[model samples]
Target: MLLALPPLYLKYFEDGYLLVPGFWTIFFFISALTLIVFVVVLTVQQKNNEMYAQAFLGATTFKLLACLIFVLIFIKKGRPEKLFFVADFMYLYFLNTVFEIYGLLRTLRNQNSK
Candidate 1:
């Protein structure tokens, strides 16, 4: 998610890499959102704990920045092709979300079993 920001937003929107393979971008978006949500729920569960709370807020801020940057780029692009890429990006976001959810669940189960 955060690791892939430059290519997804900067390259795709700013440098016109919109025509490149979008599988990575899609995976990134989904992964980013999933982690964002996971961090959020974890934060809520550990509401009174400062360490986890800080991490969650940090992640929320990053995700918010990414969303803002995305919207800003879209406003500047303003084209049908751009819209197409955005859809592809969003599709990947959800796919990554599911994968992250499964991964986190597996991690929890493993820790419990151990």
Candidate 2:
């Protein structure tokens, strides 16, 4: 699926900068998908939500950092390219998707345990 994007993305890059590499789109997609595995793994991997949440928070913080860098780059350019401005949000979106999935899984576990 990822391999399918570059030519199409390049076709549209004329419309605007892609911000992150084409590879990251695949990575974000894959990473977001892992939350199901994450939830399943949680049953055996970590003993509690706090540990998982902490790790997830740290990872999400990194995603935000990557977005912030692109934002800073866009800011430094002064003109602020519209494509990057929008692309920058993908990081937040990816992080939010993962965080929400994790949160929902945790909630489900807590509810089920009770």
Candidate 3:
């Protein structure tokens, strides 16, 4: 829903195809990271419960660095509505981060109950 809404707005009300493609790219990038994090955390949790936290932290650092690199690359590409791009990027980043944290919390809760 988050990924699709922007494009609809752009198509009906905007002039460019900027936000749609960029949002899709970022959405997939973040989705991949989320999957990797879940897999790594689940593996470590199963293999050595003591390492689960560390695994989560490592994955988070990786995601943060990846996002930074992505932003840097976008900035280096050109000066096409730089502020809007950054703002949209940050908004999506925050939305995804919150979603991830919510998922993590739910996972942790389930684990604790078990």
Candidate 4:
């Protein structure tokens, strides 16, 4: 998915500039963040599967807060590409979130079946 984003961005958003340095960096960052969240949730599920919802919520909150901070700092740095940055960021966030939820549900289902 991350690998495919660049073409989509180039095709759809000609002016889109994800994160400061480039799209690849931001993509990797978001991908890494998603992995961290997924791992943390998996750990929590192993310890107490019933806490999946809470764990997901907490991870989401943390991600949102981190994104907010990033946005604030980016804005402060005088990056005038708000629309491009925001659109790409939100797209990445949404995609990663859905992927996370799907993986969690699959894990839950597997555990329940056992």
Candidate 5:
């Protein structure tokens, strides 16, 4: 929820700068999906290091490709405010990437300590 505050505030109170229609719904859905993927990947990681590595790499690649497709579709059918979409997309993408990395590092640190 913390990740959503700025966007939510902007959308409702700040003249909706850097946002598109249905932005919150898309943001929340993506965030939830990413969280689910991370949890599943981490659970698998705990069972087998080899599979963990492969799963992690595979998940990352899949996410990148999916995001690319989403961007393409958005460009084709999205609103006229292209620049706002870019800003919103980057905000979600980079922050989610950071969270994913942090989760991976935390899990690794726990594994190492054990």
Candidate 6:
């Protein structure tokens, strides 16, 4: 939710310059995917620490593929403008990727300490 504020503010207050159509849908999809990946990684960490790296790699690959498919479909169906596409891509993928890394690192740190 915190990641949503900047885009939301830009969309509403800045005349919707940086947002594409269906921004909420894109946001929710990424959010759900991130949450699912995080949960799967943590479950793997708890169940088999030695397999954590493989699980994380698998999850990351799945996320990238899913995002690629989603972007292709969105481009075909939504026909969003180039600027909107760039903004949406950065917000949806880049920010989420950063968040996922931060979350994974924090979780791993906590697990190691315990």
Best by lDDT: 6
- The regions of model 6 sitting more than 4 angstroms off are none
Answer with 2 or 6, whichever has the higher TM-score: 6
Write candidate 6's Cα lDDT for 1-66 as tens digits. Answer: 788898878877898866888888888888888988999999999999999999999999999898
- Model 2 CA lDDT for position 97: 61
Off by over 4 Å in 1: 1-61, 78-83
1-114: candidate 1 lDDT, tens digit per residue = 443665557565796545344446435554666666676756554465435446555655666577658656654665435655666565555455556556556645674596
Per-residue alpha-carbon lDDT of model 5 for 9-107, expressed as tens digits? 897799885787767756875687678769878888877876987888888888788878877776777564777777788888888878888889898
Model 3, 35-75: lDDT tens digits are: 77777777887798778789888988998998899778766
Error of 1 at 26 (Å): 6.3
lDDT of each: 0.56, 0.54, 0.74, 0.76, 0.79, 0.87
- Clashing residue pairs found in predicted model 6: none
Look at candidate 1 and tell me the lDDT of residue 58.
65
Pick by TM-score: 1 or 6, better one: 6
Reference-based lDDT, residue 17, model 3: 57
Off by over 4 Å in 2: 1-50, 77-80, 87-92, 95-114
Model 4 alpha-carbon miss at residue 74, Å: 1.9
Q: Estimate each model's TM-score.
A: 0.43, 0.39, 0.78, 0.78, 0.87, 0.94
**Native-referenced Cα lDDT, model 1:** 0.56
Model 4, 6-101: lDDT tens per residue? 646675778533443455556777778889999999999889978988998999898878877866776677664767777777777788888988
lDDT at residue 113 of model 1 (Cα atoms): 91
- Candidate 2: worst 10 consecutive residues by lDDT? 16-25
